[model samples]
Target: MARIRTIKPEYPVSEDLASVSLPAERTFVCLLTQADDEGRQRDNAAVLNGALWSLRPEHTALDTEDELRQLAETGLICRYTGCDGRQYLHVTKWHEHQKISHPTASRLPACPVHEPAGWCGKCKAKGKGCARPAPENFRSLPEALATPAEAISAQRPCTAATDLTPAVDVSAAEAAAPGKAAG
Candidate 1:
């Protein structure tokens, strides 16, 4: 099933996307919607061509395979063979880019190379980097927003009640009313 996917403003500007052909760039974006909640999808060129480029008969499975290869080479996606002996691909920045409110369990197998067996979003290796990293052109939050509270607030509208900073001083305005005299 196809799911809604987000396209970051930096996607078009990404160096990886720029390196690939226009068809390959479109394929990369189309794969985002086709991927499961865990960003895993079948890597068969025929299936991808049928699902993503059916309207454009000119785009053949061979073209799709070439696009997939470009995406894998650019580090935009990781292609691996599952234990089931089937080809699969995982979007490298799916977790970082897609904010699924209630993610559905993935039916596809995780990438053995990028993700450990039975990987559940967290990595056991302390020093090693995670499978999902920010895109090449995207910058992560600064050190000031490293905290959970600050990070959460940064995403939504901030009010006096929910804001991390000190609340407004309303006492001065209250005391300066027309009926009240200044002390």
Candidate 2:
């Protein structure tokens, strides 16, 4: 009978701690920083939503609609309820791209027919129109029509031609005569 040889498997043993190079450590740090930045952005958005909810609970649903859509597109906010209630705003499922940024640098200019042209109604009535347009331009139709003539006329030119013409300063009159304008 021939003699058979047996071979033993060898395993390596380590004694010193594994050393990670400075560059590798740096790479890890950079990854952590990016993760932290993303987290902070999410937190900021939550705070903004909370503030809006506090200010106008009724409009809370609409306040974050645009933001929510953006999140969905970017895979942030995965699912959201649409205004219709039947359709769901799914970021990943959307066929078309939706704009995630602010609609404009600022809110759209108020409708000239409804909003005051220059300043507050009190100022308009006193013939001292506001230095700036009213901040609250959104108002009901009844309210817009009910504004005081003095407030409306304050900013209006003395010429009768422009009297009936709709001007941007209409909000001033509406603010002054809430009963008539807001009715």
Candidate 3:
């Protein structure tokens, strides 16, 4: 379930997000930063409040809720009832903002336009190819993979597709065995 989230450096200016109050701006960013690849997440104010507390300690649950409400009103995010009957928040501009290579199917409701592009080379055929969420520790997807979630020694390099071993010289072997054909 570990993945990355990318926010272009020009997003704030390009999106005109500076006009909103600081808290609302932060909330919107948090929503994007914490959400899964499709920009959908449990629409629980308490959970969101907990996530934002470190950044804005003086803010309360009610404040976060208000900001989320504003985001919805402003067309930045939308709330929908999942098939499971639980409410979730889906960022309206997720696909517009992100460049997903070949996206997987989203768990959220249908969007105004097409969903993001994403493809998991390993799971695209059967359709389990949606983009995954980033880990809690990193800001986004790539950092998590590059730095790793656990100890360095605990990790293993993924080299299944390529070989990097040094090639050995066969001249010595041929010299040692004159009569034996080089099998």
Candidate 4:
């Protein structure tokens, strides 16, 4: 079943995301909610249409298939046949945007083209590396979806979230207390 997914506010302005047609953009956004915790799903257009565009009778499975091709071509998503010979797709930057607290393991096989050899959805082998490391080609965080700290630092020097003090008059607050002096 599909799981909840995050859509950072920066999505609409992303150069790579904006490169696609509006329909394809909508498809991409909708696909976010439809994806598994690992950002994977079956690559059947008909199934996707039934799940994603069911309310909109105007859209068809063929349209979804075309959008999928557009997403793949733009490197937003990866499509491949698993070892079981079933087709699957995964968002290329799943980890960059999502911060699932307790992600469930994916039942689908990993894409061989993107994953290390003998990868079994787990980073088990010594020195094999992360099972789903972010792609090297990803743009810097400022231009892409960034974590809260990255976003803050991109605009200014990094500071802990707690360092931000609330705007209030301390003397007035102290005066309001029954036993405190205004000074």
Best lDDT among the predictions, by candidate number? 1
Candidate 4, residues 110-154, lDDT tens digits: the string is 655565453454334422433343244322124557888787889
lDDT of 3 by residue, 78-164 (tens): 765433445567788787787767666654543222333433322343224243332223111244453453455357554457686
Task: Name the runs in model 4 displaced over 4 angstroms.
Answer: 121-183
Residue 44 CA displacement from its true place in model 4, Å: 0.4
Please give, for residues 1-183, the per-residue lDDT of candidate 1 as tens digits.
888888999987899899999999999999999998889887788999999999999999989988887888799998765545566789988899999999886656656566664443333333232333223322222455368886677886676777574475557579678997656
Residue ranges of candidate 3 with Cα displaced over 4 Å: 1-3, 14-16, 101-105, 108-183
lDDT for position 86 in model 1: 61
User: Is candidate 1 or 2 superior in TM-score?
Assistant: 1
- Per-model TM-score, in order, reads 0.64, 0.16, 0.53, 0.63
Q: How many clashes in each structure?
A: 0, 16, 10, 0
lDDT string for model 2 (19-118, tens) is 3333223222222222211111121333434543446555443335444433433442233211122122111211222332322221122112222242
CA shift of 149, model 4, Å? 65
Give each prediction's root-mean-square deviation over alpha carbons.
19.4, 27.7, 15.6, 20.1
- How far residue 19's Cα lies from its native spot in candidate 4, in Å, is 0.9
Alpha-carbon runs more than 4 Å astray in model 1: 117-183
The ten-residue window of minimal lDDT in model 1 covers 132-141
Clashing pairs in 4: none
Q: lDDT (0-100) at residue 76 of candidate 1?
A: 92
